[model samples]
Target chain A: MNDSLRVVLAMIELELRRLRNDRTEVFTRAVQPVLWLVVFGTVFSQLHAIPTSGIPYVDYITPGVMLQSVLFVAVLYGLTLVWERDTGILKKLLVAPAPRYATVIGRSMSSGVRAIIQVVIIIPVALLLGVSFIPNPAYFVAALAILFVISGGFAALSIIVASLLKTRERFMGIGQALILPLFFASNALYPIASMPRAIQIVAVFNPLTYAVDAVRGLMITGNLALLPLDVAVIALFDILMFAVASLSFRKIIE
Target chain B: MTFAIDARGLEKVYKGNVAALAGVDLDVKAGDIFALLGPNGAGKTTLMRILTTQFKPTSGEAHIFDLDVVRDGAEVRKVIGYVPQETSVWSDINGYENLLIYAKIYGLPSRSRKDVIHDMLESMGLRAPAEHLVKTYSGGMVRKLEIACAMLIRPKILFLDEPTLGLDPAARIAVWEKLVSFKEEFGTTVFFSTHYMDEANAYSDEVAIINTGRMVTSGTADELKHSLRGELIKFSLSDHRVDEHTLGRIRGLEPVKSVVVTDSTLNVTVEDAETALPCVMDALRSEGIPVERITTTKPTLEDVFLWYAGTTRAPGAASSIGRVEGKAGGTRRE
Candidate 1:
């Protein structure tokens, strides 16, 4: 295989190995979304006055829960960067002949794959909780693509933050603080129309809103019409974020 | 012979305040073991970091095998293997897995990786612990694994920073032996830094001494020792006070170059101790001053460091031996 492909494959294998060994990470990532889907969905379902569509609360929250999991688990990309810096592995990689871009790409790909695994694990549990997957195979594929793109974008953003920050604790603090605010401001929990006028405008610009809308459309409405635009926007954001991250990382290494 | 690595007027200032390195120059020849000796914070690690392309120089240039570290970092990295002072391995992984991962990062061909991993592990004396998690290994074992990882690439230039810092005596010796064997077998240019003067003198073909972010001197161990003009002799005096006339008399001796009096001892720097010692004793005896003990010792790298760096004896400062000397070995320079 060519060098770039080999690096990507190696990184993927490494991540998978760690995931297998650290069952806690797998369980933690898998459990958070499942709880949100079951407990929150049921509790919120009783409050029909809260204004989700005639669609059951489990169905409404399933997409949001999956997207949140992707966001949360993808933060590991930044944490792993911190870990590598502390351990000196980042220096070792910095001195390698492999292209610098490949380092960022390989890491983002690993995070994206992990996010997909969590999404897959949540799917069955979502079904048992009375949430239905769209019958169309194309819609399922589109949903998967959206998940990868969104996760890749988030992971890239995490890398940029981690590279610019000096310490792991600082990065985690900034990352966690940013995540909750972004999630609350977006249309993840409710439709944009139900939100206030100012928040509706912000939700329109929120990348997560598009991701949640795109995935929810595929998994519930079986609509793939917006799939192209949604995927394109996410891809563009991923590229831009990754470029920024790579530049910052290059500065750090240099 | 072409220099494997050449650095000229290298300067690195972190945060625009801390001067980690200041206009240092180095020429490491191909296929030689060069040791950079210094105390902590002497900029040894910073220089290595810059050479390995982990950090950029604030000014000046470094070239590895004719390739610029900045403009040609990719090419430079292809030929350099750096084992940093810290243990960079993933503690969560097994030794075998760590080596394999590093091999992949070096872009080793898939067919060669398995054999390379096995060979590196065996060479580093980590074959028995290949299956064990790195966190379970001792400090010495972790260091061995790092060396194995760095060697997987079979680099042309190997930079080891404090390679034996925390290792026991036997482990340190084993590491030195492996380094020697590797250098002899592959002709790799090895540049390592150490605080151990004896180890540096014994293992390195040449040593560079750095102090306070500047290069003090660099040369073979024998050349450095021979460059000193006199033997250092000390005499314990019963009284701190010695008459100026008596001190002048000692200075007028045939081979005594200078006499320095401290609180409880008399220090004499002399060219020929055999000729100077009798003259010194005769003067002290005639003056009726009691000499408790007299000792003469060869000039060590530590003495050379003190003469050039103007530093006093301090804890952890003793290891700053092998201080680099400019031509003429002068005490002060602009």
Candidate 2:
């Protein structure tokens, strides 16, 4: 194979190996979303006064919860960069023959895979919880595409933050603070129309809102029509974040 | 023949206005063990970072085998292996697994990776610990593992930054032996940075002494010692008062370069000690100034360090020699 392809494959292998060794992290990543789906979905389902998009509360929240899980887990990707810097592993890689951009892409891809795995685990649990949806093959593909884009965009944002922050503690602290605000402001917990005017405005601009709306539309109605716009927004965000991330990463490595 | 590494006017300043490296010029010929000796914060790590392409120079240029570190870093990285100061291998993974991951990252041939990994493990004396988690290994073992990872690719030029720090005396010797064998067998150009004067003198074919972000001097160990230009005479005085009249008489002796008086001793820096000692002793005896003990020793690398950098001990360590003039000229003993 060519050099770039080899590097990409190697990076994937490395990530898989690391994931296997940290089985606890993988298990937690899978379990956390299910807990939110079961506990929050049931408790909030009883509150019948809350409005939804012609669906039950559990069903509406399932997609949002899944998207939230993927977004949160993806932050670990950037946090790992901070750990790598402290350990001098990043410096070691910077000296290697691989193109710097390829390294960034490889890491983003790995984070995307982890995000997909979490989504897969959540889907069956969502079904078991009576959160039913139409299974359109086209919608399935679109949902997967949305997951990839959102995960990649979040991972890129993580890398950019990790590169700018000097310490791992600072990175984690700032990452956690940013995550809560982004989730609350997005339509992760409720529909944009039902939210207050100020929060609705915030949700319109939140990238995760696009991801959740797109996935919710697919899982509930199997509608692929609006999937295009959702996918486009997520893709645009990913490209913008990746560009800024790669530039900042290059500066850090340099 | 091309040099393994060449750098000109390489400089780096951190975000806080700390000048880590300031206009360093260096050259290392192929197939030689070159050591850069400096105290901590003397910009050794910064220079290494730039040379490895991990940190960009504020100005100037560096080339590894004709590949520009800035412009052709990707290509430059393929040929060089860097063992960073920190032990960075994944602590949760086994030694063999760590090597496997690194080898794969370097795109080593899949078919040969197993054999290569086994060889590196055995060669680094890590065969028994090959299957053990790195977290279980001792500090010295972890360091050995780092070296093994760097060796997996058989890099043409190897950079080791403070490889033996924190190692016991026996482990330090073992590491040195391994480095020597690696260099001799593979003809790899080895560049290492160290703060230990004795370690540098013992292991380096050529040593570069750096202080305050600049190269103070560079030469073979023997050449540095020879450049000190006089025998060092240290005498233990029975009384602090070896009268000024007697000190004047000792200074008047033939071949005596200079005399320095301290609280409890007299030290003479001389051109020819055999010719000056008897006359100096005769003057002391005539004055009834008792000398409890006397000794003469040849100049050492530490003396050369003291002569050039103006301090007796390494820069970050403790020592009593006040500042030595930072002059760029060679001075001969009288």
Candidate 3:
């Protein structure tokens, strides 16, 4: 492997080793999205609030909740940078031979892996909720690819924010401030068409909207037409976020 | 070849207008243990950070083996290792894994990486707990492991901000021993910062005392102590307050070389303590400054720091020193 690739993988290895010891984080974080699925899907399915067009309401919300899981895991991964800074781990990595950009990408890549794990956990929950999985293998593969991009984009965004804040209290404070705004601004809980005109306009720009649209289009309804646009936007988001994150990451060492 | 570390007019001022390093010109020779000794917030860390390439100086220049730290930091870092003042480690990871990540960063070949890590663990005397999490290790063990991480690349120069901070006396000695052995084995030029006068005196080949971002004095420990000639007489005040009136009385005593006060403890440098003690006691008794006890001891690094830190302060540092209570401000002591 090349130097940067090996460096990124070494960083990923660090994350994997840490995760190996954190079994509770796996079981609990995975369970969180499922519980949200169970409560909202079960309670809202029969209420007729969502017009699912004869598709089960449980099916309509499952993909949205899975995307939520992706966003939750990816965005919160920034906290580790703050913790690393506090514990002097970031200082160690700063002087390392690898480029700072590699360090940022390595952390975001691990977040992508964690998102994949959550997708697996959410699958069993979808079954319990009477939701149908994607029937076509090609489209399912496409959905997973989209999921990875979504995870990568959000993870990169987390790093950008982490580099700016540089402290847990501030990073988490901003994270908390932005999390609900980003979630509610999107069509995670409802369709953008059903949301008000202003909200719909805002949702047009939220990455979570594209993430949910892509994942839900392929997984819930097998509608792959918008999948291409969704993937394009998320891929663009990942590239843009990674570039901006790399720029900001240099400031950390400064 | 240039000096192992050479810095000229090195200055760093933080964003808040705080000057962490004012103007420091330093030279550390190859294969020597050099200590930057100073009180807390006296720019020791700032100077170390600049030299280690962790931060850029606001002004002036520094070079490690003649590579400009700011412009060629990547090249400099390749040949240098830094152990920061704080615990610069991943505590949740085991000692072996910690070394592995560092080995990879240093681009150690996969074939020799594990062997190098094992050798380092063994050399640091941490092989027994190599697999155990660093969080479970004692303060000394953690420090030693960090030093091993720094040494992973066989750096020609090792920069330690405070290698034995927060360690017990025994643990401090352990870290010192590991450093000593590592130096002997690798001929690495070790540069560490500390407020502990004894740590510098005992371990380093040369010492530099920084006060308020300025290099006040730099020399061998023996030369520094011997700079201030005469015996040191320590007077323990029966009452914990030495009013200015009493201070003047003691300062007026004939044969008193100099008087330095730290709280109620009075250190009087004189040609002879025994001869001066009785005369000083007579003066103090008249002034109602009762003497609890008195003793004479050889001059030490503490006296050396007190001499330099007290004498070399700029106008601004004088007030800061007063708030620091007329002594070295750091909590760590020799």
Question: Top TM-score: which candidate number?
Answer: 1
Lowest summed lDDT window (length 10), candidate 2 chain A: A1-10
Alpha-carbon lDDT, every model = 0.80, 0.79, 0.80
- Choose the strongest candidate by DockQ: 1
- The residue pairs that clash in candidate 3, if any, are none
Q: Native contacts retained per candidate? A: 0.75, 0.64, 0.61
Point out the higher-scoring one by lDDT: 2 or 3.
3
lDDT of 3 by residue, A1-254 (tens): 37677777787677777776666787788877888788877899879897776788888878788888888888888656766665667777777767767777777877877787788888987897778887888877777777776787788888888878776668767776767778888877888888889999999999889888888888878776777788778878887988898888766655
Assess the local accuracy of residue A33 in candidate 1 as a C-alpha lDDT between 0 and 100.
84
Please write out the lDDT profile of model 2 over residues B1-334, one tens digit for every residue: 8889899998888888888788898889888899998877888888998889886899999999898999987788888999899876888778888898788778788899999999998999999988888889988888888888888888889999998888888888888888889889998888999867788889888888777898877889887765555665777898768778888888787777667788878877676567767878887888887889988866667777766665444231112321122232343311
- How far residue A70's Cα lies from its native spot in candidate 3, in Å, is 1.9
For residues B1-334, write the lDDT of model 1, one tens digit per residue: 7898899999998884999889999999999999898878999989999999877899999999889999998889999998887778888778999888888878888898899898888888889999988889988888888888888889998999999998899889888888898899999889999877778878889888888888887788766654654665788997758889999988888887667787878888776666778888998899988999988867666654555444654222112222322324545432
- Segments in model 3 whose C-alpha atoms lie over 4 Å from true places: A135-142, A250-254, B230-296, B310-334
Tens-digit lDDT track for model 2 on A1-254? Answer: 37656666676677776666667776787877788889988888898756785788888888888888888888877667877776767777766667776677667767877778788888889889988877788777778778866887898888888877857668768878768878888877777778889988988889998898898888775555766788788888987987788788975564
In candidate 2, residue A239 scores what lDDT? 78
lDDT at position A166, candidate 1:
62
User: What TM-scores do the predictions have?
Assistant: 0.87, 0.85, 0.83
